[model samples]
Target: MSDVSRLADRLQRVLARAQEERTERDELVDGPDGTECAWAAHERDQMWKAVNALRADDGRPSIPLDDIVQVERQAAGHSDYSRKFALYCAELAQK
Candidate 1:
């Protein structure tokens, strides 16, 4: 019901949609030839970064896009990571 909860729900839907697309494509191969997968991954990463930024300390401010992109690459194959990240964002949003 809260803003963070709403954001988390939206993110979960995004992740689910990405997963569905990947499944339909018979797995997403991230490379020059895999533009669709790459774009989906990028979108997921941006959403995660946006949520993360909302929880950053005042002094630290922004997280580098490169860092977020790297994390997205590492987490792309794991649906658990997406769910956990959404939960984390919700927790932060609560505070």
Candidate 2:
């Protein structure tokens, strides 16, 4: 498989795992110092890095600030819903 495809797959998995954990915790995953929240953010950063690695323009891993399309929140069959941010990558349009 191509390197970009492989990296994308890994990012997808990381995102999925973070979502699953947040679902199970039901938004009460935050600790006093917000360790849980921090961990989630870290995972998200790693996922972004994986995506950036696939890009050829720059060597540094980064997601364009404008590429984010939407964010969704889901409930895990509980009283409150958990936030599930979905960042959509912008596609190159042919002129």
Candidate 3:
């Protein structure tokens, strides 16, 4: 498949893991309780790292987490999120 599409698929998986981990982190009662919490933080970091790696691969500046969070929160589940993500991927592609 095309490079952008392939990258998008990878990004989707990473984003899903990141979101799941973030939920766990947010729901924790004591806030970052060691290994489990560390894992959650690592997952979140992986998402941004993947994003940055993709951008750096194309010689583009890394996108900010705030910008990505904006995209993640743009719409309710199963609404226009996919379209937004695809558009975001396309923009990231810059190809």
Candidate 4:
């Protein structure tokens, strides 16, 4: 896929995951413990669900969730962040 499409797909994956936890805070999935590394890994995986959503033949570097704060800052809209933004991007992509 083109670079633009790749970025859109990546954002969609991240947004979808975020929307699922709309009411959730920025805290870890669980309390402080030995799961910090595991939790971080899981979060990174969740944020890249679209890494393979493209064509199977399209081999490319996996997208990484470098800074989650960038996404968190966008969680501001009626209803929810991803829910609304995802819808907007979907609309734009279709046009």
Top-TM-score structure, candidate number:
3
lDDT, candidate 2, 22-85, per-residue tens:
5444343443334555545544454444445545444444555223212211222334222223
- Candidate closer to the true structure by TM-score (higher is better), 2 or 3: 3
lDDT of 4 by residue, 1-95 (tens): 76656556666677566546644444445422334334344543454444333322365433334323234335435566554444334323333
Estimate candidate 3's alpha-carbon lDDT, on a 0 to 1 scale. 0.57
TM-score of each: 0.41, 0.36, 0.54, 0.32
Choose 1 or 2, whichever is better by TM-score. 1
Ranking according to lDDT, highest score first? 3, 1, 4, 2
Summarize candidate 1's per-residue lDDT along 10-89 as a digit string, tens digits. 66676665566654454454643354555465555656555555656333445444544554555556768777555454
Among all windows of 10 consecutive residues in model 4, the one with the lowest summed lDDT is 63-72
Off by over 4 Å in 2: 28-46, 52-58, 70-95
Model 1 worst lDDT window (10 residues):
57-66
Model 3 poorest ten-residue lDDT run: 27-36
Error of 4 at 21 (Å): 7.9
Q: What is the clash count of model 2?
A: 0
Two-way lDDT contest, 2 vs 4, winner:
4
Q: State the displacement of the C-alpha of residue 38, model 4, in Å, after optimal TM-score superposition.
A: 11
